[model samples]
Target: MTPDLHWTVTVDPLTLAIGFAHVQVEHTLGHHFSLYLGPSVKCFDGILEGANGPYVGVGVEAGVRGFFWGTAPAGGWVMVRGVLASLSTNVPNTATNLGGYTSALVGFTGIVGPGLVLSGGLGVSYFDYGVLEYGVHGLAPAAHTNVGWAF
Candidate 1:
């Protein structure tokens, strides 16, 4: 990380492909620690269940990261992240679903150019749809890559 760098704004393309516009912002707290949070807007359009009709919702992610090598927001890092989402559909009299996941991830962030930041990571995520109606709760493989500008 640049000595004077304080913030970064990043986007996940994979999340966009799946119908969520996800963007994250990271801020350095010290030489080895940082905090990141983001929001996601989704339009599933009943991709998972036909009866649900159009599925729309919002999601959020908050996490703390620790850098073991290099400086904050650069080189190797580990993070514990928690995500939450609330979704509802066009179906009448249906309850909105609130779900999210928590993950532990390891990755590296590098500056490709002057201010271009690139990052990738893999980890296991514990996701609980937060509704027994969906019976969706488990540990799943997680992967992510982000491209952004560091300043």
Candidate 2:
């Protein structure tokens, strides 16, 4: 079993900035099943204009790892995760009915080393407004790279 901690900063396709701090645990689940779970802090620029707000999120990823059509340090994997985020904004003159959003993410991560990894994926989010006739849809594309030092 290998455990790692990672910090990721993601910019949405519309230039909204988001950041995450996460912990991951990876291990072989028999032959082709691996699992990862972690909690994170999710922040968005559009929600706060430029300041980051805090929201709790969790995710699970499962896929196969190892070289399939290449050599060492190069492999393919697929992952899917869901996040529920909440933020408070001070922006006036707009509809203040929306305060939270739920997002679903699906992406792939490529192995780069025994201690380093790279991943990129896309996700869509929906915001709900109570008693309102309108909502917002958001699209986010993210990339992450992390290096770990085992102890």
Candidate 3:
């Protein structure tokens, strides 16, 4: 077990692999719960390219997590997260895409070594936005994972 950590910041590797930069930061709210905020931005053009131009988006992810037992920063947990975003093209005349994403998941957080942290969860993901018209959104069983250092 690692020492008590008040804040944890994690980056989603899968998102980075696909050109999106995503990160989440969580702070302990006593022994049973914590709150997190994640800001995501599209930094690459290959993923959402349009004939007119490339597309970009800025979004926020926020959620609350419940620790099943024991202290936070480690052990089993449950989370409910919501994401709201707007996507638009570099071209001036295109319409902007907007929508919300929400998920409920169960997962585990562990201190693999010292203050290093690894977390993974499985859940369903939903999205209803103009972006989906471009076939960019998927309604399927999804899983999420992240790696970071806790301090």
lDDT agreement with native, every candidate = 0.76, 0.36, 0.73
The reply for model 3, stretches above 4 Å from the true place, is 45-53, 129-132, 135-138
Candidate 1, 21-111: lDDT as tens digits = 6788999998999999999666543233421235566788888889999898888999888878897666678888987778898998897
The superposed Cα distance between candidate 1 and the true structure at residue 139, in angstroms, equals 1.5
Q: What residue pairs clash in candidate 2, if any at all?
A: none
Better of 1 and 3 by lDDT: 1
TM-scores for all candidates? 0.85, 0.42, 0.82
lDDT per residue (tens digit) for residues 1-151 in model 3: 5547878999988656555577889898988888999897765644333311266667998888899955786778898887777877655677788765677888888876667889898888765423433424546455678899888
Model 1 pairs whose backbones collide: none
lDDT score, candidate 2: 0.36
Sorting all predicted structures by TM-score, with the top scorer first, yields 1, 3, 2
TM-score of 1: 0.85
Q: Which ten residues in a row have the lowest lDDT in candidate 1?
A: 44-53
Better of 1 and 2 by TM-score: 1
